[model samples]
Structure formats: C-alpha cells, structure tokens
Target: MLRVAVDRDGGVTLDDVADATREIDRVLEESDVMGELPFTLEVTSRGVDRPLTLPRHWRRNEDRLVKITLVEGGEVTGRIVASTEESATLDVDGDTREVLYADVAKALVQIEFNRKKKQNDSEDA
Candidate 1:
C-alpha cells in the first residue's frame, strides 16, 4: 500500500491524513495487478521535526516555530507569523519579520514546548 497525506481546507489535520491514506489504499487495490490485500500503512501529520518546504506544509503549520533559510543565504528562526500562496511571514525577533517561500533552501518545524516536556519526562522516568 502506498502512503498518502492531504490537507483539505488548508489544515494538515489528522482527518486529512486518514482520508488520503484511505483513498490511496482504495486506488491501489482497484488499479494494481495484485488483488487487494493487507499491507503496512502509516499516515500521520508532519512530525514536530518535519521540514516545511512546500506551501501546503506551511499552511498546515501556520502558527508553529520554524527555521527558514532563504535562497539569498539569510537564515531565519522564529514563529511562523503568517502564510500565503507565495510566501511565509516569520516573526524573527519581537519586531523583525521576514517573508520567504520556495526560494527557501531549507525549512523545518522547531521543537515545541509540549514535545520538549514529554522528552524531559521520558528522560526522568
């Protein structure tokens, strides 16, 4: 089975992953020469460590922390301030803002507070 992920209405919600995975499974079963059979499948949202390169990925992570590298060689690490079809606005410092897009050499979701807390708990335990 092929993996799939889709974010309808601009949100990478769990339902989005589920729907895409289901549809992909259906198509594969109907189209593939092999008859339908159980196969390993994994469908989930972008992880806390996932990179946000495409516009759809950015849309899914509208208000999360991210590190962005512009094609011009500038680097930005901050919260995702806003997003559009062409670019993403980031709140770098308290007042600074940078708009970047596919020209980005790299972009990744920054680890969040909750995730960090969980890590700490696991370590302590």
Candidate 2:
C-alpha cells in the first residue's frame, strides 16, 4: 500500500486528498513507476498526532491547543495564539508566552472532543 500524507496551511480537506490521489495515479500510470504490480494508494492528511516541527506547521495549528516539550527540559500546554518563522505565541492559563522554535523539542496538537465553537453575531441574536 502506498500512503501519502498531505498538509496545508489551514488544513487538508477531502477535495485536496481526492485531487492528490488523482494526480498521483495519473503520474504512476504515465511513468509506470509501479511496474505491473497492483497496489493500493491511500492519501490522507497529516493527523493531529503529528508533531509540529516547521514554521508552517505551527502556523497551521494556530488557535488549537498544543503540548510542547522544550529542548531545555520541560513541557507546556496551551492554545497557539500566533506563530512566526522563528517562534510561536501561546496562551497558557490566560497568560501569553512566546516560545522560540529553537527551544522546542517537540510539539503536538491536542484533541478536544467537546471544544466550544465561537458563536457568530447572528447566532448570538
């Protein structure tokens, strides 16, 4: 089975996966990269469990909760308020903390099953 992990700034949608799969299938068929052997091609998004390593990854996860491990030795859990190429700003317990990418050993997005959605003005009325 061939598995392809797709990622985007905001997130990966079903349409994106479908488009990628079609393109990949076309390329493989044209190039005959897989020879005569039949195989399954599975395309999916980089799951929430995937570690945030790049600036883009951090940017993509903005507004999401994350658990970060510092290189110096410690952990922090907070919501990603903002991120730049060099660092990310997190809201931890109502306090904002800026953490440089160089200081981050690992970071993973946390899953919230019952997260409250931001209510729109129309919804408030």
Candidate 3:
C-alpha cells in the first residue's frame, strides 16, 4: 500500500485524510507518472513509532521522550528540550545533552500514556 502521512499545526482529521486522498488521486490521474499502474493508496497521520530522521521530524517531536541510537553505538533516552536543523538538546536525567543530527542513527518517540499534554501541542498518530 502507498501510505501518505500528513500532519498539521493543530491536528489531522478524517476529512483531511479523505481530501488528501482525493487530491492525490486527481493529480495522479492528470499525470502519467504511474503509467497506467493501478495502485491502492492509504493516507495516514504520522505515527509515534516512526523514527526521527529529519530536522523537521525532530522539531515536530519536541518535548516527547525518545530513545536515540547514536552512530558511534551509544544510546540515549531523554526528553526533548530543544531542537534545530543540526542538533537536538535532550534532558537526560536532569542533565542536558546536545546531539547532532549526524550522530543519530535512529530515534523513536517513547510511549507515555500518562504523560501530560503540553499546551495544545500533543504528539499524535
């Protein structure tokens, strides 16, 4: 299945997914990119299980707890404090650690069902 994940400043709704699917279908029908291939599409919002790979991904996950695997084989578990294009600052056991994007091999948001929602920015799937 072709998965289309989308997010917004507030949140994504069912209608948003339906609208996005329709728009994608319309665009593909107007173009020859698929070359008569019949394909099924599944549109979804970003899931917490998805790894944090890009600067925007890191930015989107600010304040969430994460487990990061370093390129040098080090592992870090911390709550995201701040993030930029090049690095992320995490609060690791009361100590703040700064990690460069290049040093991160993989990063995934940790699940915390009892976690309090920060302002209006709660990470959603």
Candidate 1 residue pairs in backbone clash:
none
Cα deviation of 104, candidate 3, in Å: 1.2
lDDT of 2 by residue, 16-120 (tens): 999999999999889877889998999999889889999999988998999999999999999999999999999999999999999999999999987777775
Off by over 4 Å in 3: 8-40, 117-125
lDDT against the true structure, each candidate: 0.70, 0.92, 0.86
Measured by TM-score, the strongest candidate is: 2
Error of 3 at 28 (Å): 7.2
lDDT by residue for model 1 over 1-119, one digit each (tens)? 54544444345666677787887767766786545566776676556576776777877786677887778897788877677888887777676575757588889887665644434
Evaluated at residue 112, the lDDT of candidate 2 is 94
Q: Clashing residue pairs, candidate 2?
A: none
Best by lDDT: 2
Query: In model 1, which regions exceed 4 Å deviation?
Result: 8-37, 114-125
Task: Give the TM-scores of the predictions, in the order they appear.
Answer: 0.63, 0.85, 0.68
